[model samples]
Target: MENELLGKFKLVVGMEIHFHLKTEKKMFCSCCADIWEKEPNTVVCPVCLGLPGALPVPNIDAVKKTQMMGLALDCSLNMKSRFDRKHYFYPDLPKGYQISQYKQPLCIDGKLKLESGTVVDIERVHLEEDVAKSFHEEGKTLVDFNKSGIPLVEIVTRPCFRNIPDTVEYCKQIQLMVKYLGIGEADMEKGQMRLEVNISLRTSEQERKDELPKYKVEVKNINSFKFVEKAIQSEIIRQRELLENGITPMQENRGFKEGSMKTVPQRSKEEAKDYRYFPEPDIPPMEFTPEYIKDLKTNLPPTPYMIIDKLEKEIGLSRNNAKTMVEKLGPSYISKFEKLLRMGADPIQTSNLLLNKKEYRNVSEEEIIEVIKNTKTAYSKMEENELNAVIKKVLANNLKAVEDFKKGKESSVMYLVGEAMRMTSGKNKPDPIQLKQKILDMLDSDAN
Candidate 1:
């Protein structure tokens, strides 16, 4: 919204996400997948390095995982998909051309629904082998083949996002979905998941309806979700400025600089000639039968969005809170919490106790049940206001700490709450905030 230069242009965003599979060994080799953290070149084998007389065999587990992921995303599973060579010259690529899918991908024609009820269509989900990582420092660059030949699944989405928030939400939702499906860890910090954003701007409906703009840009190697959001916002502003000055944004690749929160030019956008992609001769075409696809579909987990909606409707939880709780606590924990709520424990209180309050540490659920059973007799006798009054009195006596909270030292309120709970023997029915305010008023009266 800050970008005002392009005379009202609509921002469009698409993402290509690559997630490394959590497997024991490399895609085509027996070498361990632990190479990512190991010393450089130590985990590499002849097959991964594409040495002479070495042949590549597809990893069955990796293939099954890709199929399962496809099923979870509601994608069409291709019975057969062949590996192609994406030829390029880079220090990291040991084979010189990556073994990837071109014409035939593992999955196609999928859609993901966002929280806003918008569905982003997925173009394809393909399988490939990851290349080695290159480390550059000082004056030289070094190649680490430890990560070479790891199994990866690349998901490409259609250009559908209209703003920064939508793009971010889509990425986060997809990441969660991938995690829920048990496909991959999808950890951006560990390089297990990476993102590439393709962005373009079009003139608004009211402006220049006769001709559409052809200016487009690609931001590559955006690792973190925060960086993806920031880079898109920065690029939108940058392109708008250029267009305002009667300049069209050129088609090119840009790198995101985390420190400065800006995008820097990396290289010109390459056409098909740049990659020189061809059929991979070293690997054979992989085929899957109908039974194989059906087996994978049976193993697919429920999508995170679906789970969120069910939890909200069935458990009477807010959508956002349920999503957060389910994500943090996992499905098993959520079920336990729901059971406790059904047994007459207050829902909000139960949520807070499970998530925020750590007061009953080291106590088993059985012990909690026992305590609740004994306390309910005394607790139910008093009205809510009367129970809250006892809590307020306990917090009011903690004068010094209450003063700290009133002076904007808000973190001090925790100490007051803890003390109040202790004084009331955890029997008070008042909310934490009411106790804190009562303590502040007592302090003010004492000062007067």
Candidate 2:
């Protein structure tokens, strides 16, 4: 089936994502990269400012973090990679050029598999220096050099995406990966992660008579994932309308307007010739030996998918719970919860405590495991008198909850179970599931 709005064409989209690396300083300068929390222009240095005499020294940690990122993406580590001068002139670029990779990138040939079984091929992951942010204030624009020269990584994907949801999912997956890697925050609100969507309309599979589109229109620097999705969908519709009217869409760079939910052209697309890319004389080529890449791999954490798989397989966590754990919690938190699960904690209860509440932050792992142990021990069928006595006391203490439960709010029984657990002293504690069933039987008997 084809989209009726698109007529004879199908959508093809690729994304270029930029993430600010979590390095301590600028990519090629000693200036602190922690300027996000600082006032403007205070975090600049001569090297970051691109003064005539100043030279750039590469950040080895940034390179290593990039390779670690590559390993997490299942990308092949480029043993030999180098940086080049991407010459361009903009108010934000003090150097009138950017130090980025062109021919040889740091990582190559990776694949990101979505949960829906769609695998998008990664073209390359390259290292680069960030440009200063431009702020348009009242009657004038301001440039903040504090963010200039921050270490950044650019991931380019092949044009394999055909729908909006898959594209959004891929973006989300990458955000989770970088956060888990601890390489970058990938925070969209902070301008840490940016998305560039390249999309074009091509003839549908059944409509082979129509000519395919040759030019790609890129919507760049989308700050939010929702906007990125909307921009792609809007571009598809816009391009299809052009083709239907017998006009070819122009190749241009565009920006997403949130108020209108439309993509407006920023500038006509420029070729590599416009930038005149060449080798950067200030920085030398980066070459990593087998031992270095191997060492980098050791520091890399497991991918989010792997962590999700482990949680689901080992603990019998629901798919949704596993996804939440992998996306919301970092590698350390996931590892901690996995250890507790291995210690025989109930997955359902532990997962509930892990998320949807912040109180677990104050609870220790030992304390959580102790509760699980007590619950398991307490559910071994106490003497009938003791069980009935605990239930009676719990029901008495939670009369409102009892009434609510009898009045068809079944969820109130869990509150009564908490009371029953509180009534049991010592190492014995009630499992909410088992206690709820016992209370149900007791209430039914009273009714009869």
Which sections of candidate 1 miss by over 4 Å?
Answer: 2-7, 206-213, 331-350, 358-429, 433-448
Best by TM-score: 2
TM-score of 2: 0.82
lDDT of 1 at 143: 85
Q: Whole-model lDDT for model 1 versus the true structure? A: 0.75
Question: Per-residue alpha-carbon lDDT of model 2 for 1-448, expressed as tens digits?
Answer: 2376566678888999999999988899988888777888899988887788889999988998888878888899888899999988888997789999998999999998998789999999999999988999897889988989999999999887878778999999999999888888899999999999999988765236544458899998899988987898788789888888899899999999999999998989999888899888877887778988888788678889988897778767656567767877677777778777778777766766666445664578998776656544333446546777989887777788878876558688778777787777765655455556567657655544
Runs in model 2 lying further than 4 Å from the true structure: 1-4, 205-212, 370-448
Q: On residues 1-448, what C-alpha lDDT tens digit does candidate 1 reach at each position? A: 4344334787777889899998888899999986546777899888887677888888888988887777777899888788888888788885678888888898999987776668888999999999988989998999888888999999998887776767888888767777777767888889998899998777776234644357568898889988998898888888888877889889999999998999999879988777887777877777888887777777677778777777678765555456666667665566667677667776544554565545643356665555455533323446555655765675567667766765547687678767765656443545564454445444444544
Say which candidate scores most in lDDT: 2
Per-model TM-score, in order, reads 0.80, 0.82
Q: Report lDDT per candidate.
A: 0.75, 0.82
User: The CA-based lDDT of model 2 is what?
Assistant: 0.82
Worst 10 residues of 2 by lDDT: 375-384
